[model samples]
Target: MKTTKILLAGMTALLLASCGTHKTLMEQKPAPGDTPRPAADSTSHKLSYVQHISDKALYQKNVVSNLTFTVNNGRKDITVPGILRMRKDEVVRLQLLIPILRSEIGRIEFTKDYVLFIDRIHKQYVKAGYNDVAFLRDNGISFYTLQALFWNQLFIPRQQRVSEADMSQFSVDTHRLEVDGSAKIVLRDGKMTYKWVIPALWDQIAHTAVSYTSPTHGTSELSWFYEDFRPFGSKQFPASQSVEIHTPAIGQRPAKTLKASFELDGFSDAGDWEPFTTPSDKYKKVSVEEILGKLMNF
Candidate 1:
């Protein structure tokens, strides 16, 4: 009887080992490689509380001030002292500096689809559709969403825009857990690749690196470093934020890098989040053809 019991125990151990091996194999994911993109599901995944935390963190009641760095050749930096005021599905205004013109871009206004650039110097305007903003074949004042940092805002988060996909379109992998407490998601759509890195921490995303790539433009890396989170009125604000841009081998041109810094000092959400109206006589609205004609000057 004792011999029979011992045999039974041995058999049980073997069964357990086999089961464990099977589970291990199932859990193993392939090393990132060039896998064919699969179709995405029509339905989007519901974001959990943790995922929403990043967005909630961005909806501060107070204003935000930060220094952003764009590093291309060395470090081209810009510092802006302004309040980050937003009205839910309404508008976002970044009172920042316009490097090309060498003056303040008083208010960068964005609605649901169109992005309007109001020049503080000449009081002229440049407009572009949201999707066309990425078709950066030429130079002009265009607007891109800085909304990924906030949750409860987008139906599908910006970080999830790129779809490498599984058998379904929504397939994704967590890229990195940010020091600021945001999670980064990586997705690929055709030749264009997208990256979404949201603020992970409360009121600050410190020392985080996010990248986006495409076949034509190559790759661009954006790094953010947070400094202070001081209370403005009823909410917390970032005292300073820095950004760096690196593009690898665009055309035959050696890789270009741009560094910009945004420094926010006194912030007040007192004024209306209205679009800045430029002086009609300041500058003429140039066409894409005209901008392209000046490539040699760039």
Candidate 2:
């Protein structure tokens, strides 16, 4: 009886963990003992921080990679081989296959305003505006937020356009937590903090953690840890990533958690990232209402 209860609790935590979802310019408030600097000098210090980050930003036109994906949703764990092609601010496409069977099982594509989910095994497909999905709409999920998480880019919330980013709103801090000889570098603005734990030289971050709360979304947290970054042109991309998301326990549902790990087998930054077009007669079409009903019922 005791063991069963513990197991149930563990499962609940795992289920709650499932969910998904940067910039640096910095200012350092000088210590009181420090001499006051000229206004222009202060401005230079503030601007200097952003320049450092811009140097590391990997804002790509497109990227293509083959990744081995492993995921667990509290109930079961699944491993599959997959492909990801991402075009910054535009679209992201993913294709997943069943390991040994070599059968394509699922594909998902996200655009600026829409999401398309295809279940090849069921011959079912869903294409809808982002707001059409109940879970996403209810939780205030946006395409750009997920895109940032996938693309390994720093993100600002509720900023419909990326150009709206305000450099003054953020500050950089190099001294923080440390582990395994790596220290965390943090960029923070109000309630949101973008953090990366990296080596002493601080050239790249081994992990990134972002967390924020909204009136409609409660608390949503995300983390991506990268290792063995691979080379592409002048930039480097992590060959492996550990991803996590946690949604606050709200309403009737328990707090949910989703965890996934990915290791790259191949990568490229140029290609035709065409999305899969569903055949008119190939799959049964369903309404957004039905999809919501199915998820809620499950």
> TM-score: which candidate is best?
2
Query: How many residue-pair clashes does candidate 2 contain?
Result: 11
C-alpha local distance difference test of each model: 0.38, 0.57
lDDT score of residue 211 within candidate 2 = 68
Candidate 2 lDDT by residue in tens digits, 39-93? 3335455445444443455756788888687775656665678777887777877
- Tell me the RMSD of model 2 versus the true structure: 8.5
TM-score of each: 0.53, 0.71
Please report how far candidate 1 places residue 193 from its true position, in Å.
6.1
User: What would the per-residue lDDT of candidate 1 be over residues 1-298, giving only the tens digit for each residue?
Assistant: 3322222222222211111110000111222223222123312431332233233243443233332322122432223333355554455555544444434544455555665544444444556555563333122212222443221222222233222233233223332331322344443444333333333333223344444555566555544444455555644555555445455775657764444444556655554434343436656565434332332123
Off by over 4 Å in 2: 1-43, 134-141, 158-165, 174-199, 214-218, 292-298
True-vs-predicted CA distance for residue 148, candidate 2, Å: 2.3
Error of 1 at 77 (Å): 5.0
Best by lDDT: 2
Q: What is the model-wide C-alpha lDDT for candidate 1?
A: 0.38
